[model samples]
Target: MRMRHVWMTAGTLFAGLGGHLQASDWNMPVGVTDVSREVYSLHMTIFWICVIIGVVVFGAMFYSLFRYRHSQGAKAAKFHEHTTVEVIWTALPLLILVGMAVPATATLKKMYDASDADLDVMVTGQQWRWHYSYLGEDVDFTSNLATPREQISGESEKGENYLLEVDEPLVLPVGKKVRLLLTADDVIHSWWVPELAVKQDAVPGFVNENWVRINEPGIYRGQCAELCGKDHGFMPVVVEAVEQEQFDTWLAERKAAAAQEAQGVDREWTMDELMERGEQVYGSICASCHQADGSGLPPAFPALAGNQALLDEPERHLDTVVNGVSGTAMPAFRTTLNPVEIAAVITYERNAWGNETGEVTQPADIADMLSE
Candidate 1:
């Protein structure tokens, strides 16, 4: 009984370790994988089978080697061929292979069935962020790492989420099939979430699709599975899977916000109001690479104070913010930010600092441009 308990303990430890032993670092996740668990079971099955075979084969070979040694005065047999032994060895391997292949083929079939999804979301990988668009809905947003640079640099206490937090989490209704369309803007990236059993490449100028149907409603987190750029590790993917009713409520709220934005454009606001609202929006959206004080990280993120691109030419400023300067790190804010937001940000930049143009751009102007 004591020996049996010891074996049980050992077996439990081995099973627990098996889950995380492969990539036992923060590099690759280990909680659960779509095909990995199946693969692991297949591995263990084949491994034990091999162990049994190895023991039998080696036991016979060693027994013959020791018992038939010439030093023991054993007579050498004249017969050179053993058809029975050769046939047994060949047939045994073939049977073992067939056994392994059966389960493997089943798992492969399940992994490849990426159709008939209930929900479809397009996941576009940018240089240092992820943009998600809910198909058949006007809900779309970019998710960025919310972790501060100070914490990342070890200058402060890292939050609970740390490098795994995002400003916006991809929301989904639980127990529903979700199809993800993956692609990249500049380079190759990979979208991976272990719990949901998703990992697909975000290739540039190309689209790949993967599907998942989460069993539970919870927050699932993952990082950029592929190396994107300088801030590759900073790009994290967070998913909030909520109940159907809760998801509907969230969707309704988003639509209301969109409607509010449409009404806000035509209505005029005081400079004080725009500045106040713009400050918050800019801090959340633009303060990562660009410093909070309008003094951006030099060389890479140029300061907006004396920027010719933003100050000298208003057309350039509007164009760059809306359409984005292609082939660069500056992603277009048109889709991410509403007209009122865009106008407020543009106004804040123009009027702020000594570059005082005293020009106020109403949201209506931005809306008109977007229409064009």
Candidate 2:
């Protein structure tokens, strides 16, 4: 009973500090960030220190008020100042601040040093999605929210990680520094993680870099914090930090896959083969915006079916796909997608939805694109 009372007292005192502190103490899972854990510790430390100071100062103030009350017929003595008392009060807080600065400075230094990274990734924030490019590697793809529209509108039960699941996660090797270079394709987006304690802005035309190294392998989730657009809440960040060996194997496979795709340029593909392959590529790459049926979301992603641009000139369509229009939202596929995937998607678009110009884009055409 005595121990219980002691615990209750401590709990009550802790409860007065902050609501967020309770979240950490309760082991409630939030963002996967080490910095958040550090911040929580700092918060609790400062909170307790403030509590102790408050109790001491306020206790003295209240004691003096009760002991020297006028109703008790005590006469008040008038004094101008207490220089010694003022010095002690001012100096004590200054000393306490210096003590707090030590941990804070260390954390700040860690946050700033986004250098000597094992892997470098460029994160480009679009209106409602994130595009990740593995620096110096052939792996690059857009990661959009995978949650269904019905669930977002409360029409259906939300999944376990609704609005948090992405088409592709930013994969990394655990225990290595993963430096992220951020920039925006459209509006401003802030990438934030509560656990790693990293938040950096993705601004237009400007690159911002931040780094993180996980101590353990786990799925870390974050979100686009800035008010980007209508689908801002939908754009979530998911990082899968895996063992170093697994990550290496994944990279090796990706490189081998790229090489295999490069070999496809020399081969002759029939229209039927290209069309079938194109459909699969189209579904993954173009379906997000242009939609599955090729109807396309009007006023934004224009329809490809019977459109003058696609139906009238097959060569122009090839040019546009290979070399995306500048000053527009459409990004060039020359670097992101391999020759086979780009050719497949382009061929699929031209032939699908009755836009049949009976045209097929070969991998060689895309290979020649790099020159232009």
- lDDT of the candidates, in the order given: 0.81, 0.80
Best by TM-score: 1
Summed over model 1, clashes come to 0
Residue 288 of model 2 has an lDDT of: 63
Show model 1 residue runs off by greater than 4 Å: 1-102, 352-355
Residue lDDT tens for model 1, 1-372: 998998799788867766655566632332333454665566667776886788688989998999999999999889988999899989989998998899989977877777898889999998678999988888787788888878987999999999999888999887787788999877899998766657789998998987776666788998889987777888899999898899999988988877787788899878877777777677666776666778888887878876767777999988988888777778788877888889888888877766588778888888898988
Structural RMSD, model 2 = 4.7
lDDT per residue for candidate 2 within 1-372, as digits (tens), equals: 998998799787667646655665464343445656676677667777988889889989998999999999989879999999999989998999999999988877877788899889999887677888889996777777878667976999999998889878888898888899999876799987666677799999999989888877888888998998656887899888889999999888877876777788879888888888888767656666677779887877778877886788777777777777777655566655677778888888888898877778887877786666
- Cα lDDT of candidate 1 equals 0.81
CA shift of 356, model 1, Å = 3.6
TM-score of every model?
0.77, 0.75
